[model samples]
Target: MNTKLLFSIAMILSISIITLMCFLSPAHAKSSTSPNIVLIISDDAGYADFGFQGSKIIETPNIDAIAKSGVTFTRGYVSAPVCAPSRAGLLTGRYQQRFSFERNLTTKEDLNRGIAQSEKTMGDHFKALGYRTAAIGKWHLGNKDVYHPNNRGFDHFYGLLDGSRDYFKQVIKKPADKYKVLQRNGELLTETTGYVTDLLTNETIDFIERNKTQPFFAYVSYTAVHTPMHAQAHRLTAVPESVVDPKRRKLIAMTASLDDNIGRIIAKLDQLGLSENTLVVFLNDNGGALTNASINAPLRGYKGSTFEGAIRVPMVVKWPGHIKENSHYDQTVISLDLLPTLLAAANAKPIENTPTIDGKNLLPYLSGANASSPHESIFFKYHSGRAHIKGDWKWMTTKLKQADGSKKLFKFLFNLKNDPAEQNNLLNSHPEKVTELRLEWQDWFFDMPGIWTQL
Candidate 1:
């Protein structure tokens, strides 16, 4: 054989191998390194709680900085009005009910139920892109070994597995209480000390320092402003009794402490010079808890109800060069979009076996590349309550129990563009619009795999 012919064949084979390698690894195939992502999810924060959102009593300068640095989403929402289901939707980029996760899991139910193992999380997507992944605060998704954070593509995990925990030492009272303590990578930490917020913040800063040289994704899901409203004595004393109601003083202090830690997180990013290269997202798991004295004023309802105050939340995203500084995007966006959007930013390719996600890539609308809303409609269902929003029109249906032990169905329709508070019900007057939105909700609800959707 001719030597020239052999060399030609060798070069052809080498080129083919390189092309296949690129196709297999999309992350490394990109010309430039993708930015780091830091997702900060606060527990039960009200729509008007942040300083940037006109909170007169609670000062949140650091949380407000996120809005100042990038885009503040005035019409953001989560899939569910509660914790477990909402977190499931956010983490998996899909409607939780699509996989039988429609309601908050009880402590016993959590042992057997969670975000399914087949569902790939945002951490799984980022990990495929060669980015270090860590889940810092709350991990209410599940307590079983299969649903653990480490098993879900997170390289590091520091938090509790249950819905809530004590800020200081978590003493196991009942058998169910065993799932509520702090842990590092799934192992219980016996000597955990300090306030939960501060300790979590320290771990976050340390994680950033350790991985400053590489791209990473930090999911900081804080349990702040939640129940067991324990706050440091100093923070409580700082608030004057005359400025606000005595009942709300502790919640205010807890919120203040959370704000201070947020400041620490931002400062750490700046110190490591990772600010410009990092995409920071700050939002709430759901709406505020009215019983907790959270001020969700101007918006009706509270945390477990299907009202504007329960689903709609404050979302701020800061990406230095990509998103405009201090801009406000009024279009509706949901927690389901976070994974797809983050993976797109990371240049990560979707796997063939991964389940289909309901979220859209929000970059086009968020960056002005597209001028329309990210979604045409959003739907929610928890027990006997159901809600749907299309454009500016909103429809809600609830089952009220009567004194005779019977249930009554009440429907409401409101034009959110004009009445953001949902004060009036137009279901009778706008029968046509009511039928349209209700039909849409029925289609979505029935399509879900949960038991509640069986009918």
Candidate 2:
């Protein structure tokens, strides 16, 4: 062979090797391709309860750090005003009403029913993408054989199946059966010693430790600041006794403790060198319960209502290098959006025959690729009450019974941009707006298969 020809071939081989290295390196390929997802959901938390949301008393440095490190959504909302239906929407990324899950699960009969088996959950999608998935904390979806977390695509499950559990220890099983109890992968845990929040956080850390080398999805659904407002005595030292209301003080302490646990989870991710690639999402399942002394100031109504205070929640998403730090997204976003957004971040695709996802991939908007809002309109329905938001306009109807017993419907129209609290009723002034939104809602409601029969 000629010397020039031999040299040419050698150079070509060297170039090919360099190209292959570029494609295989961890910096540009392999582990860097898919990000880990940590979805943290709080139960019955108020809209303005956390430090990032402008709370004066509650100190949530860890939760606030997520907000400062990424994007904080001001108009974030849950699909439903209450827990079960809201969670149904979150887990499935679709309006819960579409699947006939519109109310809080109240009985064993309801417990038997949960997110339909046919529906694909975020966990199922992540698991299909070759990622480990675990659900630790509250699993209010269901306790039935088909609805268990193991069947719902989680490899590990540690938490309560019911709504509210005692914060400390004692378990009551006699009278009404409303008390919450611990369950680990369908087996009843006779006694879980430590605080539930701290225990769940430790379990989450363990899950991360076991799966740190691979991509994993951790759904940390905390049952904190909910009912059974029992905060650890040590956590309440900062809260003053001058605050005469004991429930409020306990709730404050619970909020503080939740904040601390959040910090612990983040610290664990950082310690494992996983913080940069981990997508941490923080949000509440729904608006707070007034009976629990939750503070939802600057918004109207409480947990079960269709108002902004009930549906709108505090939400923060932190993806170290991908999303801009310390930013705010004011346009409407919902809990349903989490599934699609996380799937996009993880480079995963939805399963075939998956139901139509109501959530939009929020990456474009958060990354400034899209200037317009992710969603043009959002709707809500519970019992006989209904609400619809299109652009800045909102139309809602409230059911009020007369002195005798019959029901009366009171409708109101408001421009949320101007009157976020719904203090001024514009129904009389803007009849056309009311008609347009009402018709829009009616069209969507007809397609829902219509679930509010109990009302």
Instruction: Give the best candidate by lDDT.
Output: 1
Give the alpha-carbon lDDT of every model.
0.87, 0.86
Which stretches of model 2 miss by more than 4 angstroms?
Answer: 1-30, 170-172, 175-179, 400-408, 452-455
Reference-based TM-score of each model: 0.92, 0.90
320, model 2: CA deviation in Å?
A: 0.7
The positional error of residue 408 in candidate 2, measured at the CA in angstroms, is 5.1
Residues 1-455 of candidate 1: C-alpha lDDT, one tens digit per residue: 89999999999999999989976764554324688899999998888888988998789999888899999988999999998899999998998888888888784545777788778888888887778899998998877788889999899999888888898887887877767788999688867889999988999999999988778899998999888788899998999677566658988899999999989999999998889889999999989997678878789888988889999998999999998999999999999998888878876656557889889888889878999899999999888789999999999977766999998988899999999999988889999999999999999888678542311
By how many angstroms RMSD does model 1 differ from the true structure? 3.5
lDDT of 2 by residue, 25-124 (tens): 5334535578989999998888878899998877789899999999999899999988888988999999988888888889646756788766889889
In model 1, what is the error at residue 215, expressed in angstroms?
Answer: 0.9
> In model 1, which residue pairs have backbone atoms overlapping below 3 Å?
none
